[model samples]
Target: MVVRTFGISVLVTIASLVVAFIYGSWEAVALCAILGVLEVSLSFDNAVINATVLEKMSEFWQKMFLTVGIIIAVFGMRLLFPLVVVWVTAGLNPVQAFDLALNPPAEGSGQESYEQILTDAHPQIAAFGGMFLFMLFLNFILAERETKWLSWFEKPLATIGKLDQLAVIIAGLSLTLVAEFLADDQHRATIMIAGVLGMITYIAVDGLGSLFHTEQLEEDHERDVASRAAGGPSTLVKATGKAAFFLFLYLEVLDASFSFDGVIGAFAITADPIIIALGLGFIGAMFVRSITVYLVRQGTLSDYRYLEHGAHWAIGALSVILFISIEYHINEIITGLVGVAFIGAAFLSSVVANRREERSDGDSTPKSGGGESPSEMATATD
Candidate 1:
């Protein structure tokens, strides 16, 4: 797995650099490398989080993840998603937007100016951020209640399967409508709509998954219902495959959550559609792949027990920040930094406690005799 991941990364790096060079070397190269490191660092926890879901998947799905999923992430989501968002927000044709993003007023000032203009022109990113946070909050709560408890009381919670995809689609349309209808009215309503829409989307998708899910392709409700036959419990029974699909949707939402800040931040850096696409796109996809690889290879979810917990907490915090950005913008640096700090503190505490326990144990060894050794007795007495 490690070797394969590394090989994939190398191939991607080469291909991305080729694109970057075709665009021009300096900014693209620098941006790619920087975003590479930044993404790698920011998404380390994402890999571990994904592993928990990925392990349960069938080999075919896993293979699809490595092949088709990466393409969606790299070409579709990472590259095109931003440009599409920018085009929609800026109200420019793709050609103009691409050109504007690619070529700005000054050489050194290309990045900053473009970002400022994008921010000024669009103003909907705040909506995306806010919406992402709200969706995540719902997701985490639903995930928590359902996973940690299986009682009948929690049965209603199982219906939460609908919220993941709902968030993004709602966020997209809400922002689009806000940019359109409520241009100057109650600005906050946009956030509310986005939030509610995201929630509904999640519910719709996951609920459908639960209601119509099946392990066998032919046994599914889509098939059985089409045949006009009442299928048994096995027809709608949720398998890890369905869960994996939702989990993939959940991860995409999470990626969008992280990218919401980074996307907006791209304006802060450079808005060259090609630059953004080639640079941030490369880095983001690479990091996502690297993260998935790390989790699979290192088995961090198994090894670093608290890493997943920490990241989910960070995701939860980020979710709040996203919602709050509707009224009070949260800086991305602060968001990532605070998350790192919280997790770092937790990690350090774990390490320190581990070392202290090890030391105490070392000093409390039993002697050959049935009675405790002097050191052991002294340590015990102390």
Candidate 2:
């Protein structure tokens, strides 16, 4: 199962290495390898979060994530998004932007133009992606729910969530505050506009998902009563078709949010867009998808409860980092390590919880040595 899941990743890695070798020398290949590792490490939390949503989706959508979704992640986000950023920031044609990326300015020119263009656009990118991610975290932590990993924080937020659209309010205020941090008037306006767009995108996608929801709808009011009368909790049935489409959209956006950092950080390693796409887009993206699928098939989320919570928390941290990075440059290595630390802590907590449950179950079992139930003693004697 593991090999089957990761087969494409292995192929992608090999193909990227070969492409990198052709692109330049062993040095290029090594850079590709480093970028690939960086991408996978930085996005491990993304895989975990993707699995949390993907598990709720139907099998067909799951397959689509590997096929159609991979194309978007690799080509759309990794390759084309950078060019688009350059184009928008530099006010250059797509061809010119692509050329600039392929052949950067000389080293002694203080900094590479391609990198500088991307850096110039960082404020807008951070505002957009950070707002989107911040909303995701707000929704998760604020939504009214009984299952909570971080009780003190989540409980209060859930209580606040009782007020309708409070997450949006908090998120909007957050964007305004962050925007104020930008000293340049143009940069501040850009952040505000981008932040609003980010919030709008989230609301639009969420509304679309609700609009398309049909599986839980009742044909007759009588049926709902009967369903409620049953002792079991009512199941929220989602229509396979509409639900999958919305889920696919959500997954794509989620992937894009994760890729924003990678796209910018790739410039730090190499100015060549093709190599960046080959390394982070092809190989790294494939590995993340593979991990998502593996987690779903193996029921890893069920086994390690709180993993999703950890991933979301990691996302929240990343979102904060993204916002801070607009004014201050934070190292990609630091970002990656922070995510790993959160995930590792969550994993350890899960392990401890599992052990506690095992001990409780063991203690609850009827023992023959003590005054046990007659049935247990009979079974033991038999």
**Which candidate comes out best when scored by TM-score?**
2
Whole-model alpha-carbon lDDT for candidate 1: 0.58
Candidate 1 C-alpha lDDT tens digits along 1-382: 6666677677777788778877777667777666655555555545555666566556666666767776666667556666576577667676665576666658665343345555643334545544555554445535534132223433454455455554455445655554454445555555545555655554565555444333444454566576555543333322346655765565565565566666666555556666566555566666566667667667655554455556656666665555455445566667667668655654665556567778999878656465777777778879
**Collision pairs in model 2:** none
Model 2, runs deviating above 4 Å: 106-112, 214-239, 369-382
lDDT of 1 at 155: 46
lDDT of each: 0.58, 0.85
Q: Work out the TM-score per prediction.
A: 0.67, 0.90
Runs off by more than 4 Å, candidate 1 = 1-3, 103-124, 134-186, 205-243, 327-330, 349-382
Number of backbone clashes in candidate 1: 11
Give the local distance difference test score of model 2: 0.85
Residues 321-368, model 2: lDDT tens digits: 999988888999999999999888888888998999999998998666
Each model's Cα RMSD? 9.5, 3.6
Single out the weakest 10-residue window by summed lDDT for candidate 1: 145-154
The prediction achieving the highest lDDT against the true structure is 2
